[model samples]
Target: MSVHRSALCRGPYGGEGAAAGGTGCSDPAIFEVARHGRPPLPVCPVHLGPALLMASGVLWPPEIRLIGRVTGLRP
Candidate 1:
């Protein structure tokens, strides 16, 4: 069964939530995603960046679906 737990934000501009009730963002302590064999990892939407933003490539057409297959993550 899947578990629910708070996760710390891993964004580049994260880690300002533990200030003992200070006036700062709470780092969006959200749930985690873990596979049965893999360990739990924090997923911050802020740092994920655009879903498709190829910087420099030389291909007729980028296979975007391949990413989901390789990483087992849904688009």
Candidate 2:
């Protein structure tokens, strides 16, 4: 038998959250793949709750981009 190791939530934002010692919240629920990478977290930034970044087969990039443009955030 073989077992695969899944990723973990760094934090609400990404690795920084993890580095900051954030354990992440349980609102929208974390998925196997969602935790594997950084950014596009499975939680709401406002409430620090779980949420899906995608909606109706479309990704919510505009909002993220806007944040980056305004804050000059790379990730």
Candidate 3:
């Protein structure tokens, strides 16, 4: 069995692990983790979370936060 980040890393803009030490899909912390290693994350700098960073009292480059959600279909 294998676990891909695409699965583990997909969710709303605040998903946990999204940032290095974040607590949601869109956590800036997850970006830090994705910055390295195989299957590099294709995160757009422009879509980075500025509001989140500000609320968290963290700083980052100028950009917009592109938010989305990953959901499973049920039959």
Candidate 4:
């Protein structure tokens, strides 16, 4: 699958313990994550951990899977 590196990380951020204001991470995306039949989301390494944790809580059996890697992208 073709992956876009231009998209910024879509992982939610800026909560009680995180820096406030921003709703998601600003880092460039490194992986394209697919959530079952839902549209894929771009996520960076920095937020991947938190994203997974959040997903595990929301979905009974987390359906999030790595579908593609953004070429030439690094954390």
Candidate 5:
């Protein structure tokens, strides 16, 4: 599913009366993400960091220790 031109962020937001399982964030999307055979989805800058971090963790497991070195983290 390609993201529409006016797509909003698909990140999770915390609040009451939010969509059944959706984030209440109505921020405009700044990026399009496609992963694991999934269609592209829109994402806003505010939520992009966490998405990228999660992707990194999945792509590079902690046991590898390469992520920390590459990112300049002490871990």
Candidate 6:
């Protein structure tokens, strides 16, 4: 059972309700695969610039997602 907690991936599909806290957190927390935890939004703070302007106030697609060992930022 893969959990979304916000499950806010880079695509436009899964972020809606989870980002709005329906799944658990409007501001979901980011965790290492098993190491540490941080707030998910700031995890990809630079990526969130557009999200800030999106007027939707979703909780992800942020720069904090790029931190440490995330996969979406890679080529």
Per-residue alpha-carbon lDDT of candidate 4 for residues 1-75, written as tens digits (9 for 90 to 100): 344646667764323335332355677766545554445555677666666665323343444455446456477
Evaluated with lDDT, which candidate comes out highest? 4
Segments of candidate 1 deviating more than 4 angstroms: 1-4, 13-25, 29-41, 50-75
Error of 2 at 57 (Å): 17
Error of 1 at 46 (Å): 1.4
TM-scores across all candidates? 0.24, 0.23, 0.18, 0.52, 0.49, 0.22
**If the candidates were sorted by their lDDT against the true structure, best first, what order would they fall in?**
4, 5, 6, 2, 3, 1
lDDT on C-alpha atoms for all candidate structures: 0.29, 0.31, 0.30, 0.53, 0.44, 0.32
Better of 5 and 6 by lDDT: 5
The list of candidate 3 runs beyond 4 A from truth reads: 1-12, 17-42, 49-75
Per-residue lDDT over 1-75 for candidate 6, one digit per residue giving the tens place of the 0 to 100 score: 135444432322123344533223233333311112322333123334433444233444433233333445557
TM-score of 4: 0.52
Backbone clash total, candidate 6: 11
In terms of lDDT, the poorest run of 10 residues in model 6 is 31-40
Better of 1 and 6 by TM-score: 1
Tens-digit per-residue lDDT, 1-75, candidate 2: 012112333334343433532345432322322332344432224323322332222233322311111123476
Tens digits of per-residue lDDT, candidate 3, 1-75, equal 122333333212323353532224442222321221222232323324443343332223422323333234375
- Model 6, residue 2: distance off in Å is 15
Better of 4 and 5 by TM-score: 4
Which pairs of residues collide in candidate 5?
A: none
